[model samples]
Target: MKKRIYKDIKIRKLFKRYEIRRRLLLGLINDLSIPLEKRMEFVSQLNRLPRNASKVRTLNRCVLTGRSKSVYRFCKVSRLALRDLGSQGLIPGLSKKSW
Candidate 1:
């Protein structure tokens, strides 16, 4: 059925998005030097049940820099930026909630 096929496609996309988020969040937490437990908590809070394109773009901007040529480029930028922020202790805590 066409509807079943569409549903399957949607589910696959959702799984892929979750995989991306997991990878990105793990990288972020590692760069920030947060404990694994805390990282998991942050990821749980940040994860969206349904991905939104606008939200993803906004998060990408926050985590990365440089012109968006491709996903690999973005990943590089994000890793570098995260290291810089970590070294500077710029990563915020709960009290500074408004980012």
Candidate 2:
């Protein structure tokens, strides 16, 4: 688990460092006003960036237990923790529904 967290942190740091440049390159690549040659250059630069810098490489982890599976994006918590909190009425506007 710690190894997973460390890997995620490393990826996140790389992503942060390259995020602005990546966005700029992507924008340049997609801009129709730019010359095709310039756009191709930008595409090559983007491709040269480390693959771990991509957002797709980041994994969501639970806030409470650091579990990677069944995470709730809105709350940043694992499903198990969310369910427990909901059952305890600790989270407002969230409740367990009964059929």
Candidate 3:
């Protein structure tokens, strides 16, 4: 019997892009102190970037939010925004101490 190998190639690709965008947006939010509600708009702009952009190697949006903006504008996870996110759980794992 041959061993079977299962790999979700599509998911892997999507996740890779998601992670990149997530990190980039997080950094921008932290530095700019942008609100969560407005972050989506910024992310949407980035999602439209040309495919050649190295930061977003792939084109994929956050599944939870279902917004292409997730590809660019990430909710601020800094201590300042943590209090709000904590109460609302708007962005997961975004804690005051994470920064």
Candidate 4:
């Protein structure tokens, strides 16, 4: 639990640090106006970035329970946690469903 959260934090930090560089490199690489040689340099720079820094490697984790699955993007909590909070009337506009 804590281990997953810690690792998530570390990855998030790395992503934040390298995100701009990655975007810039990708933009340059995709620009047709740029010479192929220059674009190849950008591609190489993109490949040199840390694996965890890539957006695809980032985990969508529940902010409260640290669960990595079934997390609500807007709420940032797992479905289980969301149910619990909603039942307790903690989440605005959320209520128990009825037949």
Top TM-score model: 4
**Candidate with more favorable, higher lDDT: 1 or 3:** 1
Between which residue pairs do clashes occur in model 4? none
> What are the RMSD figures for all models against the true structure?
18.5, 2.3, 17.4, 1.5
lDDT of 4 by residue, 1-99 (tens): 999999989998999999999998888898999999989988888888999998888899999899999999998999999999998899999978961
Q: Which regions of candidate 1 are displaced past 4 Å?
A: 26-33, 51-99
TM-score per candidate: 0.31, 0.80, 0.26, 0.91
Return the TM-score for candidate 3, rounded to 2 decimals. Answer: 0.26
lDDT value for candidate 4? Answer: 0.91
What tens-digit string does per-residue lDDT give for candidate 1 at 20-50?
A: 6666765776666777788777677556445
RMSD of candidate 2 to the truth, in angstroms, is 2.3
Worst lDDT run of 10 residues, candidate 3, spans 1-10
What's model 4's lDDT at 1?
94
Give the alpha carbon lDDT tens digit for every residue of 10-42 in model 3. 445555656677667657656657777677776
Residue 14 CA error for candidate 3 (Å)? 0.9
Model 2 off-target regions past 4 Å? 85-99
Clashes of each: 0, 0, 3, 0
lDDT of 2 by residue, 13-52 (tens): 9999999999999988999999999899999999999999
Clashing residue pairs in candidate 3 (N, C-alpha, C atoms within 3 angstroms): 43-69, 43-73, 44-69
> What is candidate 2's TM-score against the reference?
0.80
